[model samples]
Target: MSETDTDATATGTPDQRLHPWSWLFVLLQQLRQFIVPLLVLMFAGRGDHDAWPYAEYAEYAPLAGVLALVVVSVLQYFTYRYRIGAEGISIRSGLLQRNLREIPFTRIHNVGVHQSLLHRLFGVAEVRLESAGGNKPEGQMRVLGLQQALALEQLVRHHGSGAATTTGIAERPDGAAPAGQAEGRTLLSMPLGEVVRMGLVSNRGMLVVAAAAGLVAQASPERMMGNWLEQQVRGAAGYAEQLHLGWLGMASAALVLVAVAMAAIRLLSVALALSQYYGFRLIQTQGRLVVERGLFARLRTSVAPRRIQAWYQQETLLHRWFGRRALRIDTATGGGENDPRKLRELAPIATPAACEALFVHLLPGVQWPPAAWQGVPRRCWWRLFASSVPWTVLLVAVLWWHLGPWSLLAALWLPWSAYAAWQQAGRLGYVVDARLLAVRGGWWSRWWRMAELDKVQALQLQRSPLDRLLGTASLWLDTAGAGPLSPPLRIRFLPHAEARALHARLGRVLAARRMRW
Candidate 1:
């Protein structure tokens, strides 16, 4: 059959089918989702065969299920077809349901092209198109020629920028760029050293260890894993006793062991970071930003600046020591679930100056990290300290039960807590201008959240009984695509009147401007 058969005249392009191996990819995807359940079914069937009348036939159940899925995948591969049009793409699928979806280029907020090791071996890629307010990808092409996939991504991007009026793009089917086409300027690239630095500054290794331990403890019966850990610790203690080491020597040995473990965790983090971001690069091309990374499974994702609803910058104590900051953006691409496909990281690790330049370039009129910050009320410090009092009291109570007089030593924490609260409160501040509003908070781990006035979807002024008593209020700004854990776009501990004035001013600006995303 002709590859470009003009069967879809309305789209001004030929209806195209996925790669011949698309069925295999689809089957693999299905298997990945059900592999654990399939394993459990097979084992249970084998172990309990003697308990049921048709027990012997149970062994074949998983095989039968696999065969059925294979048939479904083949049918889906043959039935699915798509056409690229001037302004949008059309997808048709399903045999009985007969589903047809048309997604406009303008509405497509993020385009993700991924290539797994298997796909790379077959010279194919998977393409996912996401639009605003979607629970899943608007379109997912499981297997396409790598060249064709990139061309489709380029087509959508160009159309979004009004650079295309037809289905064609300046790219060859074999993956050659059009002659004289300007290659995008690279905004940031991570070499192995930087990746290692990022790994050193992150706690990914510790998180992995904690998650693995939790999983082990949950999976084991009767606290088997915990018992094993306790036995190992006792064995180590016995070995130390056999060595006849003094208390000082034992302490030194323990310190050395702890240091070694810490080193190993840091190394693990570096390895993980390298695997995920070996060839990371961010590029700016034709009014859009593209990021490509990964060592094993490569990803190339692109998004328009206009689609970004909010900006986030974070600098932990480690980040400050390493002179790096992480920048992320909230985009209109919504998958309802925590979508890994979303383009969140603009820069995973970069110097503060580099981040500033990127902000200036992407958001032409807005200043970053706001030059001047207005501090929160001093009473907010007292409020913060007071909130910690109950927790401190609880700790002291627990300690006193364990060691009567030692509980008084825990009271020393109150003074440290008060100092920390004072420092954090001093760092809590907000800045605003005609085009941007930003809030900065945190003491040891600093962060800034900012958004354009036009992107602010709602404004809220909150006053609690305690806040009222302290003559303080909070002003919160809401934006599209902001996650529950995202740093609140809020300025807390403002004087009541100041919060009202700021809220009213922001409300007026939002009312006058139309939200772009």
Candidate 2:
């Protein structure tokens, strides 16, 4: 067949291999992962690379390891092959054992193209493919020619569902469709202002600093902060004592140091956010959504419509004041700290208008926090308030036994706890729309998260002893994509009658549509 005919069929006469640079990438990865062990082996057990106590073993160990790694990498490069056919893609790989992985086009949900510093320099990209039921991406092409990667990505996206198998993207004039066409619909763009907004609204910088600080402390507490920080604290106290400045002077010094640290962390966080989301863009075309962004290491992930499990809208107290929110789509493709195709950010900082447009575009016809949210009966509110009384009573009893008259102060907590519980009950509500089960929660901070009924894995009606007496029930919903540690999304304190009605309604909804996850 001609090149055009072969492309049209989504088939290649010969299997394709990764870019030759893949071996270098693999070597770097292995070295980075095992460098600590290698360093310990060299420093703790022996001298440096040039000298060792065990001249016979240590002298040849490095050479042996290097040779083995090179052999494995070469075998991997020669053995790894992927073939694209009319039905789907097949990958053949492994050095010690032979394994063939067959992935049907219909089962594929996410495709990610990553261009690192090396990939950019080499004019190649890493293309990763993931299915719905996987915790990690199943197939990855470590390196492919830039144009070829894009072509393969588009092939899976447009023709995977047999949407345009006959008139494939290869047959189209030039490369892409029109700018405003289905595949080119610009959904959201993250500007510098939005990136700044995201930075201000998130604690990622503090978290990053904390993580590094923790690692340093874990490795050597004295080297990290124990000795130096303790000495500095003692010196500050001594200086205050010498100057007759009292505790106030030491407190001021500590405050100044904390302020400086805060400013440094803030700047680092903003810079990090800007660098990560520099040119973020979300676009949709031909029933698929594609995200492209990042400054240093660019990323492009194409998400099939069927993979998305839920919509999550998060807004901190600070974020709410700016009238901007972060919107994300959770998918059942790849769930990992570095997974590009998991919680895809539709928008880092979206205005109200943008949020609505994205919501309608991503999940059309499903009303958000539906206007007809039904509140649980009034007695349910009393149950919530009463639940806090026991904890307060225990605290008050402890204070009464220990502090005598000061125990009265502990009684003050009862009213505060009851008030907080009342506020929680007031804010908590649920909306069971035809296609969605929207749960409205939070008192100090608000969150409006919803899952499609079809994606609901299990529905349970629960009743506590109090709930049984009050004729109320809690409806727990388990969505397909929920992780092991994730709490079930549910509405608490609903009337038993309504709970059963909604449970039956959920049964009907599940029956109407086929479950994908």
Candidate 3:
């Protein structure tokens, strides 16, 4: 069923009140939290004969459970009120202490309606209201009939006027019409095909490795086997007493092969898990993006479009060959251990050109330059070369001393290191136009990022000892959201004077805009 249908029924009228069954559900949830401890107590007291130890606890169990259940039920009852006001929706909740959170009409990003298996069976659903404030989520309003969720969503949109606001800018203005409506645009959605495609393309290989690890731990064979292997290796190394060099070589080869296989299996399992967890629909609704994916426990994350601080596009050498790149957008909200809102990746990699086009379409006001800007100084090349050479020389010297003639293989590092340094130095570029500052960098996979000059939070110039000798400096541009900085974005190996010029220009732009950053 659709999300809207669930909310209406879940938020029953005041006179009607919550369904009596909801109390039971809340009680059960509270009890579930203590299930493990209860089981442990039961098992520990199974054969105990102390009258006060086990018998006294058992005697009080029923009363204690009832009191706890009642207290929680009452708390749940008061903690789960949803009301619609003329200005906005206010959800009053909290068990021990009370929390009254009001979602003003203007603050609402999107209204998310969802259903789990349990809710489905009961003809109910949960409703989530997302906002840009990045506050903790209030409890799910359980058993909302579908119609209510939809009505609330509609009501929010109707009240939230379509008037343009400066806060909603995702990209700098570029004279083109906004890609979608600012007040009420659907950002993303998934048909059944997209959902299934997401699932199928997931990397489930990692799950296998995790399962194997669990099995190995349960079997308790690692310690024994590892010790035995260690002894065999030591014996082999000192085998002049009894064994031949040929046997030692063969044993070592076998051991190395086994270790390699184990590592490969572990890596494969992790990849599989990532694929499974992240497989689902990423839809846009109003001011927020919704991500729904997971195998066992379904997750629905709502991220406000305006809260997105930065976008990162990454591609490994292999990914480039496959014509795919990974896109990551950072939002203000810090997603927790399993933060659903923090990262959204599009799998089935899109080509760099296609990815850039998609980004432009999603983020209004951002533009990709016709060609990458390349005004960086020549000193960047030498800076990169010098930084890498010292490390290369050290590694070569160490290997030559340690491995004799076999160490000649270390010579390969010099040329490869130089080539890598050149590639990295060549990739950095920056462009500043009337409305925005764009940075582009990457060797195998390129990143083209544009931010409104006004939105830059801070700018920093840094120079290492090597950078000083080369007369170059690194530039850092900070934004207001959560995400790591990138290279072209870093202004790495740019001449000191040029770096200051860019920094001053950015500062002047912010000042003209009256932006604190």
Whose TM-score is greatest here? 1
Better of 2 and 3 by lDDT: 2
Name the regions of candidate 2 deviating beyond 4 angstroms. Answer: 1-12, 44-57, 161-183, 221-228, 241-256, 337-341, 377-419, 483-487, 512-517
Candidate order, TM-score descending: 1, 2, 3
> Model 2, range 396-421, lDDT digits (tens) per residue?
78888889889888788778767777
Range of the 10 consecutive residues with the lowest summed lDDT in candidate 2: 1-10
TM per candidate? 0.92, 0.83, 0.68
The true-versus-predicted C-alpha distance at residue 245 of model 2, in Å, is 4.4
Q: Judging by TM-score, tell me the better candidate of 1 and 3.
A: 1
Off by over 4 Å in 3: 1-36, 51-75, 94-99, 110-126, 130-135, 138-225, 228-304, 341-348, 375-415, 444-446, 464-466, 484-489, 515-517
User: Given candidate 3, what's the lDDT at residue 211?
Assistant: 76
Give me the runs in candidate 1 sitting further than 4 Å from their true place: 1-9, 44-57, 169-180, 336-338, 399-411, 514-517
TM-score computed on alpha carbons, candidate 2:
0.83
Tens digit per residue, CA lDDT, model 1, 1-517: 1222233448567778898999999999899998987888798788766687999988788998899889999999988998878768878787776677777787888889998889889989999998887677888999988878887887777777778645463225554334464668999999888899999998889999999988888888977987898998999889999999979888999999999999999999998888777898999887789999888888899999998999999999999999999989988886653565678888899999988889888998676656788888765788789988998899989989889987989889899989988899989988889988888888888998988888888889999998888788898788888977679898988888988898888887787775433
lDDT score for candidate 1 against the true structure: 0.84
* Per-residue C-alpha lDDT of model 3 across residues 1-517, encoded as one tens digit per residue: 1121122222212311343456665676777887776666556555446745556466455556667777878767755666655455556655556566555666665455564556556655456665543555433465455444434444554455453332221131221223444434432434444333333333344566567767876787658757867998787567644556476776786788788876675456444444344445555655445566554444445555565666667766655555556556655443332444334453224456756765676666666644548656544665566667777677777988889878778778778767776786677777777766767765754565656665567788888897788677778887655443443355676778887887787777777777442
**lDDT (CA) for every model shown?**
0.84, 0.73, 0.57
Spell out the clash pairs found in candidate 1.
none
Error of 2 at 166 (Å): 9.6
